[model samples]
Target chain A: MEESATQPPTAATPSATAAKLAMRHVDFHYGPFRALKDISLDIHDRAITAIIGPSGCGKSTLLRTFNRMNELIPRTRVTGDVLLDGTGIYGPDVDVAVLRKRIGMVFQRPNPFPASIYDNVAIGPRRHGRKEPDVQEIVERSLCRAALWDEVKDGLKGPALALSAGQQQLLCIARALAVEPEAILMDEPCSSLDPAATLEVEELMLELAQEYAIVIVTHNMQQAARVSSMSACMMMDPDRAGVLAEYDATSLIFTNPKDKRTEDYISGRIG
Target chain B: MRMSPRLSQNLARAVIWASAVLVIGLLLFILAFILAKGLPTLSWDFLTQNPSDMGRGGGILSTIASTLFVTLVAVVVATPFGVGTAFYLTEYTREGRMTRFIRFGAESLAAIPSIVYGLFGFIFFVITLKMGWSVLSGGLTLAVMILPTIIRTSEEAIRTVPKMYRDVGFSLGATKWQTIATTVVPSALPGIVTGIILAIGRCVAETAAVILTAGSALQLPTSLFSPARTMAVHFYIMAREGISMERAYGTAALLILLILVINVAVNLLVNRFVAKGR
Candidate 1:
C-alpha cells in the first residue's frame, strides 16, 4: 500500500489539472465501525473520475462524502478535510443546503418525484427561490443538457414515474443539472439500467464531464475504463475499513497498475 | 390418523369463505331491513322540513344541520393537530424514548371508549370551560375522540411513502421543511385524506358523545354557541322515548348512506391519486 501511494505519475494526464475537490487523510465511521480510512485524493474539474470496487468496499460511501451527504445517516462521523475549490466544507457555520446545492448527486435508482416531469426538474430551482420564468428556462435547458428534452418535450406535465427506467435515470440527471452545481456525484447510477440505457447514460456523462466535475462509483470496471479519465480502485482492509488501493490515469490503472491488488482485481483474479 | 395436507388446505379455505360470507351476509341483512322499514318514511318534506311535535310529525332538517356543523368543527379543528403530530413522529424524530412515549399515549387514547371521551368533554369543555351544550362543545369533544384515529392512519400513510423520495428531495438541496412540505406530504395526501374522512364518519355516527356534549334541541342551531342535536342523538332520543321508531329508522338509514358515500369518495380519490402517480 505504501509503495503504491508513492508511485510516480506516468504521463501528462488529466491529473495535472487543478483539483475541483480535494480530500486529505479523511476517515469516516458509522457508530464504532470505520467505513473509510486515511483516504486522500484529488478529483479534477472538467473530467470524469470513477471509483470502482466490489460490493462492501465503501465506494458508494466515498462518493457520498464529496457533498457531505453521509451526514444524513445518523451516528455517522467524518474527520479530516474535504475541500471544494480548496475551502473546507465541514465548518460549523456552513449551511448544508447551500453546500449541497453546489454539489448535486444522482442515486443508484432513478427516483423521480411523484410529480409532473416539469416539476421534477424544477424542484431545485424552485426551492432556491428562483422566479417562475427563470425556472422554466432552467428546466428546459437542463433537460436538453441531459439529452432528455427531445423525448419529453411534448409531455412536461406528465407524471415523471410514467417514464421508462432509462428515461427516468436521464430525468434524474436533468434534475441534478437544474441545480446548476459545479460538480455531480453519482452512486452506481446505471446499475439498475439495461445495456442500451447504460450506453446512453455513459454518453451523457462524457458530455457532462466537459462542463462539470463528475465522480461516479460503480462495480462495472468496463464502465470505469470506457468513460473516466482518472480512476480509483478501492478494496476493503483486513479490519473491514475501505482503503484506496490505487489511483492513476484510467489507462495506466487498467493496463499497468502499480499495485498488484489493482492488477488482480482488474484481471478478474481477485476482488 | 394425521390429516392430509390437501384435506387441511380445503378445510382452511372453507372456513375462510364461510367467515367472509357470514360477515357480508350480516351486513346486507341489516342494511336491507333498515331500508325496507325506513324508505317509506323518507320524503322530500321529511328531508327538508324541521321536526314538529318532538320529531314525530316533520323532517329532520335541523338534525342534519347539527350533524354537519359538528362534523365540520371536529374535522377542521383536529386535522392540523393530528397531521402535524404524525409528521413529527415519522419525519422529525428518530425512534427513541420520546417517540415511543408519544406513540404509547396515542395508542392509549385510541383504545378508550367514546363514552369516556364524552365524559371528559362534559367535564372540561362544557362545565369547566362554560362552553355549554352547543356545537362548539360537541365538536371539540369529538375532535379529541377522533384525533388518535387520524394520527395512527396518517402516520401509517406517511411511512408508506418510499424513503427514496425524501432522499431525492434532500439531494436536490431542499431544506428539511421544504422536503416534507413539497414531497412527503403530497405523496401521502390521499391516505391522510382517507383518515380524516374516517374520522368524519366517526363524528357523524357518535351518539353518546354528541348527546352529552351537545344538548338535543329540535330548533335549527343559528350559531356555534347555540345548542343542537346531531342525527345520532336525535335517533337515540326518538327510539328511547318511543316517540317514533319510523323516524329513528329514517335517521339510521340516512347515516348509513352518508357513511357509504364518504367511503366511496375516498376510494375514488385514492384511485385517482394512484393513477396520477403512474
Candidate 2:
C-alpha cells in the first residue's frame, strides 16, 4: 500500500533531493518469526523523518537496520538491501563498526555510561582510536551542539548519572553527536521524560535536523507532528509483521493520508 | 478470629527475634572465649621469634611469612585465569551445550571436598610433577581449589551489569572486547573484587590441601621452590600433637585477626572502585 503520488516532488515536501539512506525490500526476522515485512523507504538528509506506528510494529527495528544493530541479537536474520550514500551497507566488505559510527543511535531511556560527563562523551572517540589531545575539543563541540554545554559545562567532571532525566537524555544526544555522525536515529528518546523534558528534546531535534539526518521512532503522534518534516506510517499485518503503509510530507500525512489505516491510526480510532 | 491471627503474628516475630539473638550470642561467646584464653599468650616475642621445639615455645614468624607467600602466589595465579574464564562464559558465548558444560564443570569443582583436593594435589604436584612440597605446589593447588568460586561469582557479577550499557557501547561502534573492558568490567568491579576477597579468605583458612602439597617447614621460604607452612597448619600441628595449646590458641587468634584485617582492606578497595564507577 505504498503511496506513489508523494514519491514525486511536491511543493509542500521538504527538498525532494536524493536520499542519504535507502531501504529496498528489506525484511527482518527474529529466528523463525518475521518482525518486519518487505519495506522500502528513503530517508532524506538534513531533515527529521519520524516513523510513527503502534507498538510491535517494528518502527524501532527498522530504524536499527540502518546501522545493522539488530545483528547483535542471536539468531536474528536480515534480507534485502540497505544502502548508505548509494553503497550497500550489508555488503561482505562493509565494516559494521564503521557503519554504526557513521549512523549514531539514541536509545529510548537515557543510557549515559556510569562515568563523568566528559568521559561519556569522550568514550566514543576514544574507542574509535581518536587522538587524546583532540578529545577535549570534540567533547565541547558535541555538548555544545546538543544544547547541554551551558548546564553541564562546569560539571564535565561530575558523574553523568547525577543529571536529571531530561539532562541525561540530552547528554545521551551529546554522546551520540560526539562521534560526528552524518545521521542520528532515536528510538523514543523522550518517552521516559516529563512533559518539559519532552519539549526540550523535540526542540533539540528540530535544531539538530539542520545539520544531521534524523530518523525517530515515536508512539506519540503529536511528537511526530511537532518535530518531523517527513513521516512514515506503519501498521502490523495479519501475520504479526510490520509493513509501511504511507510515507509523505508531515503536513500531507497528518491532514489527508492516502491509506485508511494511517488515517485510523492518526485519528486514534485504531491502534 | 482476629485475635488469633494477631497472636500468631506476634509469635512469629518473637521466633525471629529469638533466632537472631541466638546466632549473635553464639558468635560473641566464641569470640570472647578465644580472646580471653589467647590474649595472655600474645606478646611481641611470641609473634617475632621462631618456634622452639616444634612450636611448643617462641613465635610463628616463619609460619606467618610462609602463609603470606603461599597466599600471594595463589591469588596472583588464579585471578587472571578465573576472571578470564568468567568473561568468556558470560560475554563471548551464549547459553548452549558448551556454556552449560563449562558451568557444570565449575559446579562440580566447587562441590569437591577439601580433603579430596588435598589428595589430588599430593599425588599430582608432589609425586607426578616432583615439585617437592614447596610454596609453588601449595599455591598452585589452592589456585585450582578457588578457581570455581572466582569464576562463578565473577560471571554472576558480569551478568548483573545492565544490558543497556552494552547496547550503548555497541551503538557507539565499540568492539566486543572494548565494550567489556571499559563498561562491563568497570561497572562490575566491586562485585568481582568481592569474589576475589572470598577466594583470598579460602586461601588463608585452607590447611589440608596446603599441608599435603607444601610440607609444614617452620623456616621462612626463601623462594617458590622452598617448602612453607601456614598459620592454620601450624595451629593444627601444635594443638593436635599436644605440643602447645597456649601457642595454638595464639595462632588461632592471630589467624582470626588477619582475616578481619584482610576483609576490611578488600572492602575499602571495593568501595573506592564503586565510588569511582559512580
Candidate 3:
C-alpha cells in the first residue's frame, strides 16, 4: 500500500515533539498469568498513535493502561510508571474519576445509554457537577465535535438506541467528549461498522487528532496506515506474553520496518 | 423402531397444548364458581360495614382493613432491605465465599414452609419479643418470609443489565455508587418492582402466619399494636366454624379481585417506565 502524501512528516521522528504520555518498564499480569512484558513508549500530543497486533497480543491491554482502565478487571496488576503530562497517574493522590475525565474512552460496540439522545451526551458533564446551562452548551459542542449534532439536533429527546449503529457510535464519541478529555482511547471503533460508517469514523479520527492525543488499538493494519501518525506493533512472546516488536511512524512501519517479525506480520506471513 | 420426526413433533405439541389448556381451564372454573356464589353477597355496604355476630350477619370492612395494614407493613419494611441486599450481592462485592454464603442462606430461607415460618414467628415475635399477636408481629413475620423472593429476583434482574453500561458509566468518570444508582438500578427497576408485587401477593394470601401472629380478632385494627384478623384468616374461621359460607366466598372473591387489580396497576406502571427508558 502506498503512503498517503497528506501524512505529517514531522511525526516520522520520535523526538520532534514533547510526549503527552510516557510509559517506562511497564509489565502487567492477570493473577499469575503475565499479559504484557517489559514495555516502554512515548506518545506525543495531538497525534493519532495506533497500536496494531493479532488477537490476545495485549494491544487493548496497553491502551487501557493509559487511563488505568485495566483496574476494572479483577486480579489484574500493573507495575512501573505510566505518566500523563509528566505526572504519574498511579500516584496515591490521584483521583481515578478525575483522571478518567481528562482521558476518555470509546469501546468496540456502540453502547449508548438507554436514555434520550440529549441525556446521553449530557451525562458526563452532569456527573462532574456541571449545572444545566453549561451542560446544555457542552452537549451541543461535544456533539458538533463528534460530527453528530446536525443529524440529531431536532430530536435530542429521542431515545439514543433508536439511532443507526454508526450514529450510535458517534453518539458515544460525543458522550466521551462531553467531559472534554485531553486524550481519547478507542478500541477497534470501526470493527462493528459498515464500510461507509468506517470511512466517516476515520475522517472524524483524523480531525480529532489535530486537537486531542488519540490512541487506537486495531487489528486492521490498513486502517493504521490510513490514519495514524505513529504506529506500534505488538507480538506475543514464546511464553504467550505480549511484547512491543516495533515502533515507528506509520509510513515506516508499513514500508521499512526494522524488525523482520514486523515485516512478516505486515506482509501477512505471520501474526 | 424410532418414531418419525413429524410424529414426535406432533406428539410434543399436543401434550404442551393440553397441559396449558388444563391449567387455564382449572383456574377459570374455580374463579367462575366463586364469582357465581359470592357476587350476590357483595355490595357497597358489605365492603364498608363492620362485621358482627361472629361474622354471620355483617360485612367485612374490618377484615379488609386488617389485610391492607399487614400488607403495607410487610412491603414497606422488606423492600429496602431486599433491594439493598440484591445490589450488594450483584454490584458491591465480588463473587466469593461471602456472596455464596449469603445466596445459600437466602435459598435455604425460601425453602422453609409458611407454616414453619408461622411457628417461628409465633415463638419469636409473639412470645419472646412480647410484641403479642398483633399487626406488627404478623407483618414483620411476613416480611421475613418474603425477603428471599425479593432478593433472588432483584439480583437476577440487576445481573441482566448489560455490563457495557457500567463500563460506559465508569469511563465517563462516574464513581461506583454513582454508576449503580443512575444506570444499573434504573435498568433493573421493573424486575425489582415485579418481585415486590409478588411479595405483596404472598402477604395478602397468608392465613396461618397471620392467624398465629396477628390473632383472629374481628374488629377494625386501631393501630400497629392492635390484634387483627386478615381476610384469609377470617375466611378460614368463617368456613371452619360454619358461621357463613356465603360471606367466606365473598371474602375470597374480593381477595382475588384485589390481587388482580394490584397486578394490573403495577404492569401499567412498569410499561410506562420501560417505554420511557426506551
Candidate 4:
C-alpha cells in the first residue's frame, strides 16, 4: 500500500477532514454476471476524487452505487456496504429518495427536461417540495454557483434544450446543485463536449470541489489529474470484472503508482 | 413482350399512377354523385326539423342529435380508461406475460367485426345489464369497441417519450407516479389525443352496433336513458327498405360532411397543441 503517497493537496483543508462516504467489500452483480468485484475506498469531504480507467471498467457503476441509482436496473443486486456520513445507504430503513437527494449525479449526456431553463434548475427544489418563491432563489443560487447565471439569467424562460451542448451540461450541473447535496457524482460529464467545453466543465468541477465532495469517473487521465486531489485506478480482472487497483494522491498515482497494473495503465503500456 | 430495364421502370410508374388514379377517381365520383342527388333535398328545414312518417319525409335533426350524443359519450367514457391502461402497460409493468396478454386482447378486440360487436353489445348491454336500447347503452358499447384502439395508440405514444426524460425525473427525486404524470404523460399527450380522435371516427361511422344498443328511435334523446337514432343507422334503414332514396343520399352527404369537418378540426387541434410538445 502506498499509504505515505496519499498526501493532501496544498489547499485549505476541509473543515471536517473526515470521510464523507466509505465502501466496504462492495460487490455488484447484474443478474448472473458480476460487474464489480469486492472494492472498498474512502471518499473525503470537500475533495475531488477521480476514478480513472478504460471503458467498461465499472467506474460509472461504482459512482452510481453511492446514490443507490444502480438499483434502478432490473435484476441488479448489491452486496456489502456503502456508507454515507457513517450510515449505510443500502440499509432497509434508508429512503432511496432521500439518499439520492443527499448525493446528486450528472450523467454523461446533457439531459435537460423539455422545459424552460428556469424550470429545469427549479425542478429539483420543487420536487423536494420547496415553496414556489423559495424555488426561484434556489435556482438563481444554484446557477450562480455553477457559473451559468451570467449567460442564462436573462433567458431563464427559454427552453433548456435550446442551449448549446456545453451550456446544457452546465444547466444539468445547476440542477444537481439546486438540491444542495453534500456530494456530487459525475460520470464522464465532459466526454461528449468539445475540448474548450471540456476545459470549462473541468474548471467548474474544481470550483465546486471547494464546497462539495466531488467524485468523477473519467477516461481522460489529464482531466483526472487537473481536477481531482485523490484518485483511484480501476482495471478489469481476468474474469472481466472491474476491481480497484490502487488509491492515492493524484500526483503520486500519476508519478509513482505502486501497482504494476496501475503503472502500466498510467504509462500507456496497457489499456 | 421482352422485359427491359427502361420498360420495367415505365411499367412500374404506370402501375403506381393507375392505382392512385383509381382510388382518387372512385372517391371523387362517389362525392359528385352523392352531391348531385342529395343537394336538391338539403335545406334549412332538412337540417333542423324532425323526421316525418318514419323518415319518409322532413329532416333528420333527431338522428343528427343522437349521432353527436353517442359519439361524445363514447369518447368521454373511453379516453380516461384507455389512457390509463396505456400508462399501466408502458410505465408500471415490464413487458411480460401479463402485458403481452393485455396487448393481444386489445389487438383481437380491434379485429372483431362491427356487426359482431353489435350482437355482443345487444346481449351484454341491452339484455344482461338491462340498460335497454338507449344512448347510454350505445355509448358504453361503442366505448368498449373503441377502447382497444385508444389503448394501443396511446401505448405507442407513451412509448415514444424518451427514456432519458424519465431518468431525469427520477434522479431529481420525483416519485414514480409523479415522474410518469409530469414527464411521460405530457410528452405523450398528442399521441393520446390522436387515439381519442380515431375512437370518435369509429363511433361516428358505426351503424349496426348503435342500432342494436341505441334503438333507432326517431326522436331527440332527452337523457342517457332516452332512446336515439344515429345517421348511419337511419341511412341503413332507409336505403335497405327503399323507403326514401333522396333522404338516404342526403343523410349520406351529411355524414360525409360531418367527417370532413371533424378531420379539419382535429388537424387544427393537433397543430395548436401537439406541434410544440417538444
Candidate 5:
C-alpha cells in the first residue's frame, strides 16, 4: 500500500532534496536466505532515521546496506537499486572504499584505533590522501562535534584504549566525522553502551543529524522513539525469511499504523 | 559458599607453587650444566688463537667473526621478507584455501628440522646454483631456512594488532597499502623485532645449514663467495676432529658464552616490550 498523493513528491521536494538515500525494491541475500526482501524507502536528508526490530531481523543489515558495509562479509550479496544522492551507489563504477568514505559507519561496540586521539581522527582525512592536514583544527572540531573535546583535549596523545567505554564510543563518532562524510550508518551504536553512555550517544546523534544524515539500527523501541525523526520496523515473515514488514515516520509507526505487524511490534505484542 | 572464589581458585596453590619451582629448577640446572663444563676452559688463548688442526689447540677468533657477519647479513635479508610475508598474510589477504595452504606450509616449515634446511641449502645453493660453499651461500641458506620462523612469529605479531587500527586508517582514506604501512606495521613492531631477534639466535646457533652450504674453513672470510666457518661449526669440528681435547673444551666454553649473552639480551628486550604492551 503506497502513500499515494495527488501531488508528486518529486516535483514538490525538488529544490529541497527530500531524500539523502533511496532504495528501489532492494533485495539482500546471505547465500540462499534473503535478509531484506524487496524493500524500498527514502532516508530523509539531515535527519536521524532509526530502524527497530527483534533479534535476527534485517534492521542492522539494512543500515549496513547504505554504505555497502555488508560487502565486507563473505557470501553477502545485494541486488536492485541502492541510491545515494540520486546516484545508484551499487553500480559498477562506485568504489566501495570511496563509497564508505562518503558514508562513514560506526559499529555497536566502541572500537577506537590503538592510537592517540589525534591520530585516530586524523586517520580518515589523511588516508583519503590529504597530507600534513591542519590536524589540530580537524581533531578539535570533530571531537567537539562528538562532545568529547573537554574530556580528552589535554590528553590527545594518550592511547585511545585508555578511555572508558562511553568515551571510546564518542571517539568512534569523532573518527567518522573526520572524513567529512555525508551520512553516518550506525549498527546498534548504543546496544553495548550503558544507559548513561547511551544517553550521551543519543544526544550526540541528534546533534550530528543537523549536519549529516543518520540511519541507526537499534533494538530499543524507546531509543527509536527518543532519537529518530523517522522509524522503520522489520520482521521475519512466518513463511519467508528476513523482510522489512513496515516502514513509516516515527509518529505514524508508533502511534497509528496501517500494518497489523507494525502495531503489534510497537505495542510489544509480537516481539 | 563458605569459601571465597579467590580462595577456592587457590585450591591448586601447592601444585602451582611446586610446578613453578620445578620449572625454575630445570632452567637453572641446564644453565649450570652448560657452565660447569664450559667456563674453566675459557681463556685468552681460546679467544685469540686459531683452531688446532685435528680439532683442538687453536683459537676461534675467525669463526666468531664469520658467525657475526653471517648472522648480520642473514637477519638483514630475513627482516624485509619476514615482515612482508607476514603483512601479506595477516593484513592484506583474506582467509581461503590458498591462504590456508600457505599457512600450513609455513607451519610445516617451522617444524622441519634444521638439518633438512641444511640439506636443502646444500642442494640449492651449492650443487644447483654452483655458488661453491661460501659465506654468501651459507648466509642465504640460513635466511631461507629461518623464513618460516620469521613469518609465523611476525604474522602472530601483526595479527595481534587490533583490526580497529586498520579500520581507522582506511576510514581516513588511506589506501590499502597506506593503512598497513602507517598503522598495521608500526603497531606490530615489537612483535616483528622479537621475531627477528629470535631468528638471529637461530642463525647464531645454526651449524648444520652453514656447514652443509659454506665449507668449514678457519680462514677469515675475505669475500662473500669465500668459504667461512661460524663458531658453532668450529666447535663441532673441534669436538669431533681437533688435535687437543683442551682446545675443544675452550672453544665450547666460548660458544656457550656467546649464545648465553645474545639470548639474555633478547629476553630483556622482549620482556621490556611485553611490559610496554601491557
Candidate 6:
C-alpha cells in the first residue's frame, strides 16, 4: 500500500454542476448488524468510479444504496443520506420510483426480463410514461451504447435469454442505458463473463463513462485497475462483517495504496 | 470403510423414489381403470340428455349442465379473494408467528376431507341459512373448499419468483402492488394456472359436497336457485340404487372426457401467451 494521493481529487470541476450522485456518512444496517459505516463518496458527473472489495465487504450493498434498492428487504434501515445532484433523495417528498429512473443499474448476473429484445429496452420508457422517444431510435442508441446492437440487430424478436452469455450481459447494460439515467450503478457486471467478454464489457464501460457517471463493484483487481478512474477498497473485518478500508485513485490503490489490507488484496497475499 | 455408506445412500434414494412413483402410479392406474371401464357406455346423447329415475342409464345432460354451472361460479367467486389473500400473506406481511398462524390455518383447511366440507355446506346451505339445496348452495360450499388450495398454490408461486427480479422492479420505483402486477404475476402465471387446473379437476370430481348442498332433481335447472344434479352425484345415486349401471358408467366416462378436453383447450390458450407466462 502506498499513501494518501490515491484519494480522488475532491475539487469541483466547471461541469461539476452536473455532478451526479453523492453518499454522505451513509450508514446501512440489516436489522441489528451494520453493513456500511460512515460511508461517504462522491460519484462525479461523468467518470468511472470502481468499488473493489472482497465478498461480503458491502460493495454491492453500497452500490444498491445509491438507488434505494435495499428498501425491498424488511428491517433494512439507512441512517445517513444519498443525494442526487443537490437534492436529498431520501427526503420524504421524493418519489422513489421517479428517482430510480434517473439512477439505473446493471446487476452482476445478466437479468434481461423474460421478454423479447425489443420489449426489454422499451419497458422503462413505456412504464415511466416518456411519450415514446423514437422507440426504434432509442433502442438502437442504447444498444449501441452498451455495444450490443450489432450482435442482436437482426434478431431483436428473439427472447433476450436466447443470447450468448456475453451478449446477455451487454443487453443488460443496454437495458440500464435505455432509461437515460444520469448515473449507472453496476454490480460486478462482468464477473460472470469469460476473458473476451469481460474485455468487451470493460471497453463498453469506459466508453459509457464519457456520458454517464458509472459506479461498478468488482472482485477482479485487474478489472478495477483497467476501468475505473477512482477506486475504493472494502475489507471484511475479523467479525466477517465488512467495512470500507480505503478509497482512492485506481492507480494509487493498485500501485500505491494507504492501507495494508488493500496492499494484501491487490498483491494476492489475502482476500 | 466408505463402501456401505455410499451403497446405503444409494439404497435410501432408490427406496424414496420407488415409493413415490408407486403411490402416484397406483392412483393413476385406478383413475385409468375407472375411466376405461366406463368409456363404452359413453355417448353424446348420454351427456346432453337428462337422467330419469324412471329409466336405466339414459342421460346425464342435467348433471353435466349443473356441474358446469356450479364449478364455474365457484371458481369465479373464489379466485379474487384467493389471489388477494395470497398476495397479502406473501408480499405484504413479514415472516412472523402471526403470518405463520394464518398459513397454518390455510394448510389445515386444505387437509380437511371433502365429507367434512360437505357436512358444513349441507348444514349451512340447507338447514341454517336456508339457501336450500341448489346449484347456488353447492357453488358456495365448493368456493369455500377451493379457497385454501388456490391461495396456498398462488402464494407458493409468488414466493418462488427470484428476489433479484423483485429488487429490480422495486429499485425502478415500482410500488409493491405494481411490481407484483407487472413482474411477479406474469412469472408466477404458470404455477398459478397449474394450481387452478388441479383445483378445477378436484371440483369436477367432487360428489359429496355437491350431493349435500345441491339437491339431485335429475332435471336441468333454469336458474342457480333451482335444484340440479351434478354428473358425479348422478353416477353415485344411479350406481347405489343398482339401476342401469351401464348408463352410470357411460355418464362417468363422458364427464371425464369432457374435463380432459377442456383442460387441453385451456392449456393451449394459456401457453400462447408470450414470455413471463406459460
Best by DockQ: 2
Better of 1 and 2 by DockQ: 2
lDDT against the true structure, per candidate, is 0.91, 0.90, 0.91, 0.88, 0.80, 0.81
What DockQ does each prediction reach against the true complex? Answer: 0.66, 0.76, 0.75, 0.48, 0.28, 0.41
Cα error, candidate 2, residue A268 (Å): 0.7
Q: Between which residue pairs do clashes occur in model 4?
A: none
Put down candidate 6 lDDT per residue, B63-83, tens digits, no spaces: 888889989878888888888
Task: Count clashes in each candidate, considering only residues at least 3 apart in sequence or on different chains.
Answer: 0, 0, 0, 0, 17, 6
Q: Is candidate 4 or candidate 5 better by DockQ?
A: 4
True contacts kept of 6: 0.37
Off-target runs (Cα >4 Å) in candidate 6 are: A1-18, A130-136, A236-242, B1-37, B53-58, B274-278
Interface RMSD for candidate 5 relative to the native interface: 3.3
True-contact fraction in model 3 equals: 0.67
Error of 3 at A108 (Å): 0.5
Model 1: residues with Cα > 4 Å off, grouped in runs = A1-16, B2-5, B269-274
User: How far out, in Å, is residue B134 in model 2?
Assistant: 0.8
Winner by DockQ between candidate 4 and candidate 3: 3
Ranking by lDDT: 3, 1, 2, 4, 6, 5
Interface RMSD of each: 1.4, 0.9, 0.8, 1.9, 3.3, 2.4
Better of 3 and 4 by lDDT: 3
Least accurate 10 contiguous residues by lDDT in model 5 chain B: B269-278
Model 5 earns a TM-score of 0.87
TM-score of chain A of each: 0.95, 0.96, 0.95, 0.96, 0.93, 0.92
Candidate no. 1 TM-score: 0.95
Listed in order, each prediction's TM-score against the native is 0.95, 0.97, 0.96, 0.93, 0.87, 0.90
**Global CA lDDT computed for model 4:** 0.88
lDDT of 1 by residue, A179-203 (tens): 9999999999999999999999999
